[model samples]
Target chain A: EAEVAQSPRYKITEKSQAVAFWCDPISGHATLYWYRQILGQGPELLVQFQDESVVDDSQLPKDRFSAERLKGVDSTLKIQPAELGDSAMYLCASRIVAQSNEQFFGPGTRLTVL
Target chain B: SQQGEEDPQALSIQEGENATMNCSYKTSINNLQWYRQNSGRGLVHLILIRSNEREKHSGRLRVTLDTSKKSSSLLITASRAADTASYFCATDPRGGSYIPTFGRGTSLIVHP
Candidate 1:
């Protein structure tokens, strides 16, 4: 079974520093999602992309967070001047078009800010 | 905003026992899905129940959806220690977009 791929499974950085995470969705998946999960809470959507265009990003903190899926296959999420509250698991998921609503998730990148 | 809220923030059970978790949502949905996440890991899709369907089963997992009540339940039968994890319920609202909103998960610990 093809799976979503994520890099930097663990990241530790100081506050006010910049950090970035990468994700590669399964081949042929058109919809990609970025989510942030706080400890003990379910994941929240930060952004959604259809191909190379963003579909929704209302919940994303635009001032500090930005995500892009340049080629529509892989994506990158960056945070400038990370804050302590920004520490959480950054998850990437992808869904197959015309298929069931089930999403394939990658082992998330855990970001810890000090 | 999160649309689903799961009941019983935490649960503990012995091996071979059945565990059940419930989720209630505030809006109409196209489908409700169950996911499991182990400590320090990503979530794994468990099962999905559609609005039109009442029940679904996969392996040792069973899910039921009550559209009228906007609620769903996930049951794991004969659960083992490996089943210890946080279980979350995600809903795909019946709107134009496919964005899924998740609820605070129920932490389940199946003691061996």
Candidate 2:
């Protein structure tokens, strides 16, 4: 079974610093998603990519957060001047074109901003 | 805005017992999916029920969908300690966007 891969399973950083997380989706997957999950809450969509093109990003905080899937295979999510409230699990998911609603998820990167 | 909302935010039960969690959504959905997440980890897709389907089962997991009531339920039979995790329900709206909306989730603790 092919799986989505994520790097730096855990990250700790200062509040004002910058941080980045990477994700590589399952091969042949055309759609990718990035979500932020706060403790005790469901995951919230931050960005969605379709073949290297952004499909939705209304929920993303553009002022401080940014995400890109240049090759439509792997993606990167960055947060500059991170805030304490930004500490949470950053999840990456991918969906093949045929699978209408099912998504494959990576292990996720747990970000902790002090 | 959240599309799904789970009931009984938390549940605790012993091994061998059955656990049930309910979810309600606001809009017409094409399909509903259930996912599980361990502490500090990513989510894993468990089951999916289409709007036209009423019930589906896989191993120890069972899911039922009620499109008329706009609600769904997940049941885990003969639960074990390893089943302890947070379960969430996700809905894909009927439109073409295909973006999924998730509920807050139900935390289940299966004690051995």
TM per candidate comes to 0.97, 0.97
- Pull out the clashing pairs in model 2: none
User: What is the C-alpha lDDT profile of model 1 across A26-109, one tens digit per residue?
Assistant: 999999999999998999999999999999999999999999999989999999989999999999999985235798899999
Clashing pairs in 1: none
For every prediction, compared with the true complex, DockQ reads 0.72, 0.67
TM-score of 1: 0.97
Clashes of 2: 0
| Candidate 2: CAPRI quality band | medium
Q: Which candidate number has the best DockQ?
A: 1
Q: Kindly list the per-residue Cα lDDT of model 2 for residues A44-94, writing each as its tens digit.
A: 989989989998899999999999999878999999989999999999999
